[model samples]
Target: MKKDKPKYRQIIDAAVIVIAENGYHQAQVSKIAKQAGVADGTIYLYFKNKEDILISVFSEKMSVFVENLKVIIQESITAQEMLARMIEGHFKVLSEDHHLAVVTQLELRQSNKDLRLKINHILKEYLDLLDDILQRGIQAGEFIEDMDLRLVRQVIFGTVDEVSTTWVMKDQKYDLVEMAPRVHEILLKGIQTQ
Candidate 1:
Protein backbone atom coordinates (compact mmCIF):
# COMPACT_ATOMS: atom_id res chain seq x y z
CA MET A 1 0.00 0.00 0.00
CA LYS A 2 1.13 3.58 -0.65
CA LYS A 3 0.80 4.32 3.04
CA ASP A 4 3.70 2.03 3.92
CA LYS A 5 6.14 4.01 1.78
CA PRO A 6 8.43 6.41 3.68
CA LYS A 7 7.35 9.31 1.48
CA TYR A 8 3.75 8.74 2.51
CA ARG A 9 4.56 9.30 6.18
CA GLN A 10 6.79 12.22 5.28
CA ILE A 11 4.01 13.83 3.28
CA ILE A 12 1.52 13.27 6.11
CA ASP A 13 3.82 14.87 8.67
CA ALA A 14 4.67 17.73 6.32
CA ALA A 15 1.01 18.23 5.53
CA VAL A 16 0.30 18.84 9.22
CA ILE A 17 2.89 21.59 9.41
CA VAL A 18 1.74 23.13 6.11
CA ILE A 19 -1.94 22.95 6.97
CA ALA A 20 -1.27 24.25 10.44
CA GLU A 21 0.76 27.17 9.06
CA ASN A 22 -1.56 27.89 6.14
CA GLY A 23 -5.14 27.05 6.84
CA TYR A 24 -6.55 24.07 4.93
CA HIS A 25 -8.12 26.16 2.15
CA GLN A 26 -4.85 27.96 1.53
CA ALA A 27 -2.55 24.96 2.01
CA GLN A 28 -1.33 23.92 -1.43
CA VAL A 29 -0.24 20.53 -2.73
CA SER A 30 3.02 22.04 -3.94
CA LYS A 31 3.69 23.57 -0.52
CA ILE A 32 3.14 20.23 1.15
CA ALA A 33 5.36 18.54 -1.44
CA LYS A 34 8.08 21.12 -0.86
CA GLN A 35 7.80 20.59 2.86
CA ALA A 36 8.09 16.85 2.35
CA GLY A 37 11.05 17.36 -0.01
CA VAL A 38 9.11 15.71 -2.84
CA ALA A 39 7.71 16.90 -6.15
CA ASP A 40 4.08 18.06 -6.31
CA GLY A 41 3.06 15.02 -8.33
CA THR A 42 4.41 12.78 -5.60
CA ILE A 43 1.54 13.86 -3.33
CA TYR A 44 -0.96 12.69 -5.93
CA LEU A 45 0.61 9.25 -5.65
CA TYR A 46 -0.58 9.06 -2.05
CA PHE A 47 -3.68 11.24 -1.93
CA LYS A 48 -6.57 12.03 -4.27
CA ASN A 49 -6.50 15.81 -3.79
CA LYS A 50 -6.00 18.55 -1.27
CA GLU A 51 -9.08 17.42 0.63
CA ASP A 52 -7.72 13.92 0.77
CA ILE A 53 -4.44 15.20 2.19
CA LEU A 54 -6.23 17.20 4.87
CA ILE A 55 -8.42 14.27 5.90
CA SER A 56 -5.48 11.93 5.80
CA VAL A 57 -3.54 14.18 8.13
CA PHE A 58 -6.34 13.92 10.69
CA SER A 59 -6.71 10.19 10.21
CA GLU A 60 -3.00 9.53 10.60
CA LYS A 61 -2.58 11.61 13.73
CA MET A 62 -5.77 10.41 15.42
CA SER A 63 -4.87 6.78 14.83
CA VAL A 64 -1.94 7.20 17.22
CA PHE A 65 -4.32 8.49 19.91
CA VAL A 66 -6.74 5.60 19.30
CA GLU A 67 -4.02 3.02 19.53
CA ASN A 68 -2.60 4.57 22.68
CA LEU A 69 -6.04 4.65 24.26
CA LYS A 70 -6.48 0.98 23.43
CA VAL A 71 -3.30 0.19 25.32
CA ILE A 72 -4.35 2.40 28.24
CA ILE A 73 -7.65 0.51 28.46
CA GLN A 74 -5.82 -2.79 28.77
CA GLU A 75 -3.60 -1.67 31.63
CA SER A 76 -4.27 -3.20 35.04
CA ILE A 77 -5.53 -0.11 36.82
CA THR A 78 -8.64 1.29 38.37
CA ALA A 79 -11.12 2.90 36.01
CA GLN A 80 -10.41 6.32 37.52
CA GLU A 81 -6.67 5.84 37.04
CA MET A 82 -7.26 4.79 33.44
CA LEU A 83 -9.34 7.90 32.84
CA ALA A 84 -6.56 10.01 34.34
CA ARG A 85 -4.02 8.41 32.07
CA MET A 86 -6.21 9.03 29.06
CA ILE A 87 -6.48 12.74 29.84
CA GLU A 88 -2.76 12.98 30.49
CA GLY A 89 -1.93 11.19 27.28
CA HIS A 90 -4.24 13.40 25.26
CA PHE A 91 -2.74 16.57 26.70
CA LYS A 92 0.83 15.30 26.49
CA VAL A 93 0.53 14.48 22.79
CA LEU A 94 -0.89 17.87 21.82
CA SER A 95 1.32 19.85 24.17
CA GLU A 96 4.41 18.25 22.73
CA ASP A 97 3.39 19.06 19.15
CA HIS A 98 2.26 22.63 18.72
CA HIS A 99 1.80 22.27 14.97
CA LEU A 100 -0.52 19.30 15.43
CA ALA A 101 -2.42 21.13 18.15
CA VAL A 102 -3.00 24.11 15.86
CA VAL A 103 -4.02 21.99 12.92
CA THR A 104 -6.43 19.77 14.83
CA GLN A 105 -7.94 22.53 16.96
CA LEU A 106 -8.05 25.41 14.49
CA GLU A 107 -7.52 24.47 10.87
CA LEU A 108 -9.67 21.34 10.91
CA ARG A 109 -12.65 23.15 12.41
CA GLN A 110 -12.59 25.69 9.57
CA SER A 111 -13.05 23.08 6.87
CA ASN A 112 -16.18 22.80 4.72
CA LYS A 113 -19.15 20.58 5.55
CA ASP A 114 -18.02 17.40 3.84
CA LEU A 115 -14.55 17.67 5.27
CA ARG A 116 -15.98 18.21 8.74
CA LEU A 117 -18.14 15.11 8.27
CA LYS A 118 -15.13 13.06 7.29
CA ILE A 119 -13.12 14.44 10.21
CA ASN A 120 -15.99 13.59 12.57
CA HIS A 121 -16.03 10.05 11.24
CA ILE A 122 -12.33 9.71 12.03
CA LEU A 123 -12.94 11.23 15.46
CA LYS A 124 -15.43 8.52 16.43
CA GLU A 125 -12.63 6.00 16.85
CA TYR A 126 -11.01 8.22 19.44
CA LEU A 127 -14.30 8.91 21.22
CA ASP A 128 -15.23 5.25 21.34
CA LEU A 129 -12.13 4.60 23.43
CA LEU A 130 -13.89 6.32 26.33
CA ASP A 131 -16.70 3.77 26.45
CA ASP A 132 -14.45 1.07 27.83
CA ILE A 133 -13.35 3.26 30.73
CA LEU A 134 -16.86 4.53 31.38
CA GLN A 135 -18.25 1.01 31.43
CA ARG A 136 -15.46 -0.13 33.67
CA GLY A 137 -16.21 2.65 36.09
CA ILE A 138 -19.85 1.69 36.23
CA GLN A 139 -19.03 -1.96 36.75
CA ALA A 140 -16.65 -1.05 39.56
CA GLY A 141 -19.37 1.03 41.21
CA GLU A 142 -17.30 4.13 40.65
CA PHE A 143 -19.53 5.86 38.14
CA ILE A 144 -23.28 6.14 38.37
CA GLU A 145 -24.81 2.83 37.33
CA ASP A 146 -27.42 4.37 35.06
CA MET A 147 -24.97 6.59 33.19
CA ASP A 148 -26.01 7.24 29.59
CA LEU A 149 -23.15 5.92 27.54
CA ARG A 150 -23.64 8.32 24.65
CA LEU A 151 -23.97 11.40 26.85
CA VAL A 152 -21.06 10.37 29.03
CA ARG A 153 -18.93 9.81 25.99
CA GLN A 154 -19.86 13.20 24.63
CA VAL A 155 -19.12 14.84 27.94
CA ILE A 156 -15.67 13.30 28.21
CA PHE A 157 -14.75 13.99 24.59
CA GLY A 158 -16.22 17.46 24.45
CA THR A 159 -14.51 18.48 27.65
CA VAL A 160 -11.08 17.28 26.60
CA ASP A 161 -11.50 18.61 23.05
CA GLU A 162 -12.63 22.02 24.27
CA VAL A 163 -9.74 22.26 26.72
CA SER A 164 -7.22 21.54 24.01
CA THR A 165 -8.90 23.97 21.65
CA THR A 166 -8.90 26.66 24.26
CA TRP A 167 -5.23 26.13 24.99
CA VAL A 168 -4.40 26.25 21.29
CA MET A 169 -6.52 29.35 20.85
CA LYS A 170 -4.63 31.05 23.65
CA ASP A 171 -1.46 30.61 21.62
CA GLN A 172 -0.46 27.75 23.91
CA LYS A 173 1.17 30.18 26.32
CA TYR A 174 0.12 28.06 29.30
CA ASP A 175 1.08 24.50 30.12
CA LEU A 176 -1.62 22.12 28.90
CA VAL A 177 -0.23 19.03 30.61
CA GLU A 178 -0.50 20.73 33.96
CA MET A 179 -4.26 21.06 33.52
CA ALA A 180 -4.87 17.37 32.84
CA PRO A 181 -5.18 16.37 36.48
CA ARG A 182 -7.80 19.04 37.14
CA VAL A 183 -9.70 18.12 34.01
CA HIS A 184 -9.67 14.51 35.11
CA GLU A 185 -10.94 15.45 38.53
CA ILE A 186 -13.74 17.64 37.13
CA LEU A 187 -14.86 14.90 34.79
CA LEU A 188 -14.77 12.30 37.53
CA LYS A 189 -16.96 14.40 39.77
CA GLY A 190 -19.67 14.60 37.15
CA ILE A 191 -19.67 10.90 36.30
CA GLN A 192 -18.76 9.14 39.52
CA THR A 193 -21.28 7.74 41.94
CA GLN A 194 -21.73 9.84 45.05
Candidate 2:
Protein backbone atom coordinates (compact mmCIF):
# COMPACT_ATOMS: atom_id res chain seq x y z
CA MET A 1 0.00 0.00 0.00
CA LYS A 2 2.88 2.38 0.64
CA LYS A 3 3.95 1.87 -2.95
CA ASP A 4 0.73 3.49 -4.16
CA LYS A 5 1.75 6.88 -2.83
CA PRO A 6 2.98 9.48 -5.37
CA LYS A 7 6.08 10.39 -3.35
CA TYR A 8 6.99 6.73 -3.16
CA ARG A 9 7.23 6.57 -6.92
CA GLN A 10 8.95 9.95 -7.02
CA ILE A 11 11.55 8.64 -4.59
CA ILE A 12 12.06 5.44 -6.61
CA ASP A 13 12.52 7.34 -9.88
CA ALA A 14 14.92 9.74 -8.21
CA ALA A 15 16.80 6.83 -6.67
CA VAL A 16 17.49 5.51 -10.16
CA ILE A 17 19.12 8.74 -11.29
CA VAL A 18 21.07 9.20 -8.07
CA ILE A 19 22.27 5.63 -7.93
CA ALA A 20 23.24 5.73 -11.57
CA GLU A 21 25.23 8.88 -11.15
CA ASN A 22 26.72 8.12 -7.77
CA GLY A 23 27.09 4.33 -7.84
CA TYR A 24 25.51 2.28 -5.08
CA HIS A 25 28.08 2.85 -2.37
CA GLN A 26 28.40 6.58 -2.85
CA ALA A 27 24.69 7.23 -3.40
CA GLN A 28 23.34 8.52 -0.11
CA VAL A 29 19.78 8.72 1.10
CA SER A 30 20.03 12.47 1.35
CA LYS A 31 20.99 12.70 -2.31
CA ILE A 32 18.01 10.58 -3.20
CA ALA A 33 15.80 12.78 -1.06
CA LYS A 34 17.11 15.87 -2.81
CA GLN A 35 16.50 14.30 -6.16
CA ALA A 36 13.03 13.25 -5.12
CA GLY A 37 12.36 16.76 -3.80
CA VAL A 38 11.30 15.33 -0.46
CA ALA A 39 12.83 15.67 2.99
CA ASP A 40 15.45 13.07 3.88
CA GLY A 41 13.28 11.72 6.68
CA THR A 42 10.46 11.23 4.20
CA ILE A 43 12.33 8.30 2.62
CA TYR A 44 12.24 6.36 5.90
CA LEU A 45 8.46 6.40 5.76
CA TYR A 46 8.61 4.12 2.72
CA PHE A 47 12.01 2.42 3.05
CA LYS A 48 14.10 1.15 5.93
CA ASN A 49 17.45 2.33 4.63
CA LYS A 50 19.53 2.83 1.54
CA GLU A 51 19.56 -0.91 0.94
CA ASP A 52 15.81 -0.92 1.12
CA ILE A 53 15.69 1.87 -1.45
CA LEU A 54 17.89 -0.10 -3.80
CA ILE A 55 15.67 -3.14 -3.45
CA SER A 56 12.52 -1.07 -3.85
CA VAL A 57 13.89 0.59 -6.95
CA PHE A 58 14.38 -2.75 -8.63
CA SER A 59 10.99 -3.93 -7.47
CA GLU A 60 9.22 -0.84 -8.79
CA LYS A 61 10.99 -0.88 -12.14
CA MET A 62 10.46 -4.58 -12.72
CA SER A 63 6.82 -4.24 -11.77
CA VAL A 64 6.37 -1.89 -14.71
CA PHE A 65 8.16 -4.44 -16.88
CA VAL A 66 5.89 -7.30 -15.79
CA GLU A 67 2.80 -5.17 -16.29
CA ASN A 68 3.79 -4.26 -19.84
CA LEU A 69 4.47 -7.89 -20.70
CA LYS A 70 1.08 -8.86 -19.30
CA VAL A 71 -0.58 -6.48 -21.71
CA ILE A 72 1.41 -7.95 -24.58
CA ILE A 73 0.49 -11.47 -23.51
CA GLN A 74 -3.18 -10.55 -23.32
CA GLU A 75 -3.32 -9.36 -26.93
CA SER A 76 -3.85 -12.97 -28.09
CA ILE A 77 -0.46 -12.92 -29.75
CA THR A 78 1.26 -16.19 -30.52
CA ALA A 79 4.13 -17.22 -28.29
CA GLN A 80 6.66 -16.58 -31.04
CA GLU A 81 5.24 -13.14 -31.61
CA MET A 82 5.22 -12.56 -27.89
CA LEU A 83 8.90 -13.50 -27.70
CA ALA A 84 9.83 -10.88 -30.29
CA ARG A 85 7.70 -8.26 -28.64
CA MET A 86 9.17 -9.09 -25.25
CA ILE A 87 12.70 -8.60 -26.56
CA GLU A 88 11.75 -5.30 -28.15
CA GLY A 89 9.97 -4.20 -25.01
CA HIS A 90 12.93 -5.12 -22.83
CA PHE A 91 15.42 -3.28 -24.99
CA LYS A 92 13.16 -0.25 -25.45
CA VAL A 93 12.56 0.22 -21.74
CA LEU A 94 16.24 0.41 -20.81
CA SER A 95 17.31 2.21 -23.96
CA GLU A 96 15.02 5.06 -23.15
CA ASP A 97 16.46 5.40 -19.64
CA HIS A 98 20.25 5.49 -19.64
CA HIS A 99 20.43 6.10 -15.92
CA LEU A 100 18.22 3.08 -15.27
CA ALA A 101 20.29 1.01 -17.66
CA VAL A 102 23.46 1.87 -15.77
CA VAL A 103 21.94 1.28 -12.36
CA THR A 104 20.44 -2.09 -13.26
CA GLN A 105 23.26 -3.42 -15.45
CA LEU A 106 26.24 -2.02 -13.58
CA GLU A 107 25.40 -0.92 -10.07
CA LEU A 108 23.01 -3.69 -9.07
CA ARG A 109 25.34 -6.48 -10.17
CA GLN A 110 28.12 -5.10 -7.99
CA SER A 111 26.10 -5.57 -4.85
CA ASN A 112 27.16 -8.28 -2.40
CA LYS A 113 26.05 -11.85 -3.05
CA ASP A 114 23.33 -11.62 -0.43
CA LEU A 115 21.97 -8.48 -1.99
CA ARG A 116 22.19 -10.07 -5.42
CA LEU A 117 20.15 -12.99 -4.14
CA LYS A 118 17.51 -10.59 -2.89
CA ILE A 119 17.47 -8.86 -6.26
CA ASN A 120 17.00 -12.19 -8.01
CA HIS A 121 13.94 -12.79 -5.88
CA ILE A 122 12.52 -9.55 -7.23
CA LEU A 123 13.34 -10.70 -10.75
CA LYS A 124 11.17 -13.83 -10.56
CA GLU A 125 8.11 -11.98 -11.80
CA TYR A 126 9.87 -10.85 -14.95
CA LEU A 127 11.41 -14.26 -15.47
CA ASP A 128 7.97 -15.85 -15.26
CA LEU A 129 6.98 -13.89 -18.35
CA LEU A 130 9.81 -15.54 -20.25
CA ASP A 131 8.75 -18.92 -18.93
CA ASP A 132 5.19 -18.28 -20.00
CA ILE A 133 6.33 -17.72 -23.57
CA LEU A 134 8.33 -20.93 -23.61
CA GLN A 135 5.47 -22.99 -22.22
CA ARG A 136 3.00 -21.44 -24.61
CA GLY A 137 5.31 -21.97 -27.56
CA ILE A 138 5.71 -25.61 -26.64
CA GLN A 139 1.95 -25.97 -26.31
CA ALA A 140 1.41 -24.33 -29.70
CA GLY A 141 4.05 -26.48 -31.34
CA GLU A 142 6.22 -23.49 -32.21
CA PHE A 143 9.16 -24.46 -30.03
CA ILE A 144 10.75 -27.89 -29.85
CA GLU A 145 8.31 -30.31 -28.29
CA ASP A 146 10.97 -31.71 -26.00
CA MET A 147 12.41 -28.37 -24.99
CA ASP A 148 13.81 -27.98 -21.51
CA LEU A 149 11.82 -25.07 -20.13
CA ARG A 150 14.25 -24.07 -17.38
CA LEU A 151 17.28 -24.08 -19.62
CA VAL A 152 15.38 -22.30 -22.37
CA ARG A 153 14.29 -19.61 -19.93
CA GLN A 154 17.85 -19.00 -18.79
CA VAL A 155 19.12 -18.81 -22.34
CA ILE A 156 16.45 -16.33 -23.37
CA PHE A 157 16.82 -14.13 -20.30
CA GLY A 158 20.62 -14.26 -20.33
CA THR A 159 20.77 -13.29 -23.96
CA VAL A 160 18.52 -10.30 -23.46
CA ASP A 161 20.19 -9.28 -20.18
CA GLU A 162 23.70 -9.63 -21.57
CA VAL A 163 22.95 -7.59 -24.64
CA SER A 164 21.55 -4.79 -22.52
CA THR A 165 24.49 -4.90 -20.11
CA THR A 166 26.97 -4.83 -22.94
CA TRP A 167 25.23 -1.88 -24.48
CA VAL A 168 25.45 -0.06 -21.16
CA MET A 169 29.12 -0.97 -20.77
CA LYS A 170 29.82 0.44 -24.19
CA ASP A 171 28.38 3.79 -23.01
CA GLN A 172 25.32 3.03 -25.10
CA LYS A 173 27.22 4.01 -28.26
CA TYR A 174 24.91 1.98 -30.46
CA ASP A 175 21.18 1.54 -30.82
CA LEU A 176 19.92 -1.15 -28.44
CA VAL A 177 16.30 -1.44 -29.55
CA GLU A 178 17.44 -2.14 -33.11
CA MET A 179 19.29 -5.21 -31.92
CA ALA A 180 16.07 -6.75 -30.64
CA PRO A 181 15.17 -8.32 -33.95
CA ARG A 182 18.61 -9.79 -34.46
CA VAL A 183 18.71 -11.08 -30.91
CA HIS A 184 15.25 -12.53 -31.36
CA GLU A 185 16.45 -14.37 -34.45
CA ILE A 186 19.40 -15.92 -32.65
CA LEU A 187 17.24 -17.01 -29.71
CA LEU A 188 14.52 -18.44 -31.96
CA LYS A 189 17.08 -20.48 -33.88
CA GLY A 190 18.15 -22.12 -30.68
CA ILE A 191 14.65 -22.75 -29.26
CA GLN A 192 12.33 -23.06 -32.21
CA THR A 193 11.65 -26.40 -33.88
CA GLN A 194 14.08 -25.74 -36.69
Best by lDDT: 2
Model 1 misplacement above 4 A: none
Error of 1 at 121 (Å): 1.3
Count of backbone clashes, every candidate in sequence: 0, 0
Task: Evaluate residue 132 in candidate 2 and report its C-alpha lDDT on the 0 to 100 scale.
Answer: 88
**Residue 111 accuracy (lDDT) in model 1:** 86
Clashes of 1: 0
- How well does candidate 1 score on lDDT at residue 53? 90
Model 2 ranges with Cα > 4 A deviation? none
Best by the TM-score measure: 1
For candidate 2, write residues 51-154 as lDDT tens digits. 99999999888887899899889885699999999999999999999999999999999998988999999999889988988899999889998888889899
Return the clash pairs for model 1, or none: none
lDDT of 1 at 161: 94
Model 1: per-residue Cα lDDT over 1-194, one tens digit each: 98899999999999999988988888999999999999999999899999999899999999989988989988848899989999999999999999999999999888899999999999988887789888889999988998889998988889999999999999999999999999999999988888
